[model samples]
Target: MVILGIETSCDETSAAVIADGRVTANLIYTQQMHATYGGVIPELSSRAHLLKIAPLVRTSLSKAGIELKDVHVVAATAGPGLIGSLIVGYTFAQGLALSLGKPFIPVNHIEGHIYSGFLMNPAPEFPALILVVSGGHTLLLNVRSHTSYQILGTTADDAAGEAFDKVAKLMNLGYPGGPAIQKSAEKAVRKNISFPIADVKGDYNFSYSGLKTSVLRYIQKNFPDGVIAPEEQSEIAYGFQESAVGALIAKTELALRQGSYRSISVAGGVAANGRLRDRLADLSAKYQVPLVVPAFEFCTDNGAMIAARAKALIESGIPDYGIQEPFPSFKSVFADAPLVKRS
Candidate 1:
């Protein structure tokens, strides 16, 4: 099957073509202008998607050595993201699908992330344990199959990526804080020191808001003048990163110890984190399970994962009746829609 997938979930406008479950071409254009304001501006993000999505799709098709008429299906992210951004891609893909008289699949954005690891070489084993961490979400899942999963835990407050961004802003580091903080943290003098990730009442759910606040208070007490040297920045950055990544690993270990998963996977943008990858690798090794993480290109929002998921849904017997409106429904996953725990 030939499928064209479009993604405009946040600041990126992406398109990809998949032929028989293999990625032929995937293109992404991120809105770098958001850095000027220290974060994403929704209106501007949507506008940028409108400008780049079409051209990106055209380029993706060209790169794949195919034309629109050759595509058998069209897929696009349907939700759990900025409504404006989701609408842009959803409408575009639907329109194209209608014009070509092809089937349209509305893919869940998080579901796209969940299965991203399946696209990796030596694909993750079935009934895997996946950590889906992104800018807007943090979730631990028991993925039993391509079409089934149980949401084990979710974020009680700010997401891990959100904490990174907020802390970076506190340090005047930069926007898109995950990379910024990671870069600064790498130069830390005291590698062992770090802020603490507060223990939540739930066995597996996460809480990062307290960690963010603790970082803020520490900065205020240590650097009262609101100025920090490069070295000091590194110390704080490393400590914070340690705590954030440690918290994720801690919960994952708890779940792995209790479950019978054969593979441990990390998906979403934060899965690109060096510390998280290393820690998860060690944990997976300890548990004697293969560690599965998607290639860096698929770490963040993209189109190929959506197409890959559409293929999975089709193979799993989910029919694409037609294109529908987008909804920010984080609860409804792939075929066997399930509700995740928040508290």
Candidate 2:
């Protein structure tokens, strides 16, 4: 079946076409407007989605050499994103599904990230642990089956990606901080400035708000004049990245041990961080568990993951929706009972 997926959950406006679990075309238009602001403005993001969604879907279909009429299913991210952006994609998917008389599947943005693993690493084993670290979310999930997932832990405050952006902004790094910071860290030598990791005992939960504040304090202490030299800035960036990655790895190790999961998968926007991916891979080897990390394109917000999830739901016999309310929060999106029966 040919599935067309629409994703506007965040700043990216993306679409993709997939057939039989293989992606035929994936097109994404990232909003550069957010760069100047140092963060996303919801209203602007919504407007951007409005302007970009149609062309993106058309481009994806054209690139894939498939017409809308040829699509067997329409899928879109319904929630866990900006309400306006979610509305744009969800309403579009609803209309397309109605016009084409095809199933319309509502995919959770977080779930889409988790399923992204399958797109890159086929034949993933069940009962694996997945860490989804992104701008808006930091969650650890235990995947018992294709459709059965249990939340192991999540961030109580800032997410890992948010920390990256915030720290990068503080250091005058470019917007979309992950890549910029990663690049800067590669050239600098870190002084091993130790940052405190949250001590949430017996729980896989993460908290980055304190870590962010600690980084700020360290900057103030070292750069008393509130201005750092170029070299100092690079070193600070390196140290910050190291500390953040260390904390994430620690939590992941704890999660694996607590859940006794033999397979580990990492996804979401922050998973694109070279340092984080490298550290996680090293730790996976040490723990003797298989590690799955998606390619950079799939790691960020995209439509292919949504399409994959939609196809799974349709094949599993979940009822199709003619329409769905746009969900602005994660809680609202996954609050409903599982769409498919657990094995």
Candidate 3:
């Protein structure tokens, strides 16, 4: 099957083509406009998607050496994202499906990330421990299969990426803090100033709000003038990243101990972090299980992941095509969606 996938859930305008379970082409256009504003402005994001989605789809299909008519399935991220952005991609994909009389699959954005491991040469096995952390979400799941999951833990407050961005803003590091912090931390000569890892007390649950505040308080207490030295900035960035990733690792370690998982996979944008990747690799090594992390391209929001997930849904005896409206609420989107048979 040739599937065309569209993702406009956040700041990215992506389109991808997959033929018979293998990725043929993937294209992602990240909005640089958001950097000036220090974060994504949802309105701006949707408008940008409207302009880029069609061209991206055409380019992706062209790169895949296929025409629109060759596509058998039309897939798009349907929800758990910016409502307007979701509508742009969802409606556009539906339009394409209608024109071709092809099946249209509305993919859950997070589910797309969880199953992104399938994009690798050897996909993750069932009963894998999956960690998905991004700007809007942080979740640890014991994936029994593509259709069933036992939610191991979730953040009580700020999501991992959100915390990174917020803390970066506080330090004038940059917007979308992950890369900025990494760059700054790289310059540090010493990484001693440590931030506290939160104890959520709910077994494997996570909490980063406390850690975020600690950074602010540290700045207030030490740099009372609100001006940090160059050396101090790097050290602070290094310390914050260490603690942020440390909290995630701590929770993941707890979850790992509870299951007989054959593999461990980390996804979403934060999966792109070098520190977290190294730490998780160590944890996987300790457990003697393979660690699966999406390639940087797939780590961020992308249509390839969505298409792969839609294909899985179709293979699982699911009537994969449908008209699903964009869900704006995070709580309900996550709850009512994914069709997760929680164990």
The C-alpha lDDT values of all candidates are 0.88, 0.85, 0.89
Q: Can you write out model 3's per-residue Cα lDDT over 163-248, one digit (the tens) per residue?
A: 99998888888888999988898899977899998898858888999999999999999999989987899999999999999998
Per-residue error (Å), model 3, residue 47: 0.5
Arrange candidates by lDDT, descending. 3, 1, 2
Candidate 1 segments exceeding 4 Å error: 321-323, 332-343
Cα RMSD of predicted structure 3: 1.5
Worst 10 residues of 3 by lDDT: 317-326
Instruction: Return the top candidate by lDDT.
Output: 3
C-alpha TM-scores of all predictions: 0.95, 0.95, 0.97
The model with the greatest TM-score is: 3
Tens-digit lDDT track of model 2 for 95-182? 9899999878888888889888888745457888888999999988888876688887888889989999999988878789899888
Model 3, residue pairs in steric clash: none
